[model samples]
Target: MAEQLALRGDEKLLDLGCGNGFIIEELLPHMPAGSFVGLDVAPGILQSARKRLDGADIQAEWVEGSADELGRFQDSSFDRAIALYMMHYVDDIDQALAEAARVLRPGGLFILGTDHPDSLGEMHEVHFKALRQMNDVPSALFKSSPKNRISLTNGQEQLQRHFRNVRTHAWKDELLFPSTGAFLDFYQSHNHCSASSIPGLDLGEGFFEELRCRVGHQVNQIITQKGHFKVTKHTGLIICD
Candidate 1:
């Protein structure tokens, strides 16, 4: 995606939903003479990002704000913008796009990465069953969370409304888990939904431990037959001018 942006050495860039600065670290080498601004709503996450870039010898700024409100920056302030794996959480899609268009220079590139709604079909099935067994089904757990506003089917149309020459590319990958416990750990870390996030799911001291036991048994049964379980990730990138 850094290559797709075709960033020059001296351009200023804004990364919306720049969570922990991992992407900034990766893109810094591509833009050695460039300055970067990382914006995210979470202060703790922004602090972690600061630690990541503390000694990187790069010109970077971190800001705590919403993606839909780029008013802090002047019009046409940035040369390019990126919203990777995070636009799904924006509350207002039109407003966020307007903000991106407002702050970016004319002809500036905006790259948006979001998940396909149908992605992780198998993982969701397993999670849904486990929740049902525990009688802890929250509709948001099955449906995408309230913040998720974009999907593969509508991504192109959404971007075309505000940007020219919008195009999309699909990225797919698979992850293999040696055991149910290992897979559970990965899920807890990477997925937006987890035991702690389920609304109204009362927690006792042994809640997750017991839930893991049940889900683990089921997962182990599958592993016993198949040797390992795989989770597929489906993501799409929208590149616009």
Candidate 2:
């Protein structure tokens, strides 16, 4: 995505949802003469971002804020902006886009990176089926929610509302887990695997443990046959002017 931005080392840049400042760290050298602003709602994450930029000769500022409102910045304050892997967390995406358009200079570039809705593909299908065999998965899981959804079509349409010459790029990769237990631990930590979220389901006490055991067994079977449990990771980016 840094390549797509075509940074010339002098454009004012904004990184919306700049978690831990990792992207900035990677792009810092490319834009040595450019200034940067990192905006995020979490202060803890911003603190980590500051540490990442510490001792660098880059001109940068970290702001604690949300994308839906970037009032602290003046109109056309930025020459480029990026939103990476964090749009799903936003409730009012339209408002956020408007804010981006407001802050960006005319013809400025906006690059957004997010998961393709088909991410994890059959891996999640098999996982969900395993959950249903033991007990009902939450009805909410099937319902559309920004927190757990993305679509290339929807993403392009949204970007078009505020940008021109919108184009999409796809990225694919593979994630391998040596053991089912390891995969289970990672998923449970980042996703809604807790039984507490599905109380009305028929699952009884120790529901999470049972669900974990069954799903782990299913994944382990695949690992035994394939040597490792692999997940297809599908991600995409939208670049607009």
Candidate 3:
């Protein structure tokens, strides 16, 4: 967004669907006083965001709302808007794009950062492999965006349909771990109480222990064969007017 907007300290910026307000923290420092705002539906995440500031007088607004549907705010109220890692969850991509356009000034830009649509393809391959081991065939949840969900391919069109000069810039990174232990913390970053490798299911102590044993056995075989397993993750950006 900083690249697309060429942001300055005085610009009024909005972080749409600013989950956990991580971007807000990074942005607030560079922005001029009283120039930044954040919008998200998750109030708890917003509250956690407040704690990140340590009660320092912040020059930003936090709105508990959905970017997919901006209820208030007059047209052309902001200089720049950001939709980061969020377009994949909206219910109405077109409506969200229009609403975002509605809140942005004539020359303003809406920068979107999302999971690469193809990321799902890669995930499906890995997840289905794991599921098959557990004898659980993949379903709609793994195929497409489920109920109350969205996708990057559709999101690209939605942005172009409502705004002029829409351009997508790709940003990708492949995550590789030498050992599962390197990514266990990354995996734990999921929403609390959300299980991993086992879904709609629980792997009790014995279950995890057996998994550890089995995986360990596999790792030993790899060591003997001089091989390592690699996992990959990808993300990208879409800039629109």
Instruction: Order the candidates by lDDT, highest first.
Output: 1, 2, 3
Model 3: number of clashes?
A: 0
lDDT of each: 0.81, 0.81, 0.63
Selected candidate, larger lDDT, 2 vs 3:
2
For residues 1-241, what per-residue lDDT tens digits would candidate 1 score against the true structure?
8878988778899999999999999998888999999999999999999999899878899999999888889999999999997787677888898788888898789999888876776666676677778765445556654334687778888888888788988888988888888988866674425546665766765756656666677778889999998888888788888
Q: In angstroms, how far off is 142's CA in candidate 2?
A: 4.8
Q: Could you say which candidate leads in TM-score?
A: 1
TM-score quality measure for candidate 2: 0.86
User: Which residue pairs collide, candidate 1?
Assistant: none
Query: In model 3, where do residues sit more than 4 Å from their true spots?
Result: 120-124, 135-141, 145-154, 188-229
Better of 1 and 3 by lDDT: 1
Better of 1 and 2 by TM-score: 1
RMSD (Å) per prediction: 2.1, 3.3, 4.2
Looking at candidate 3, the ten consecutive residues that score lowest on lDDT are 190-199
Q: How do the predictions measure up, each by TM-score?
A: 0.91, 0.86, 0.78
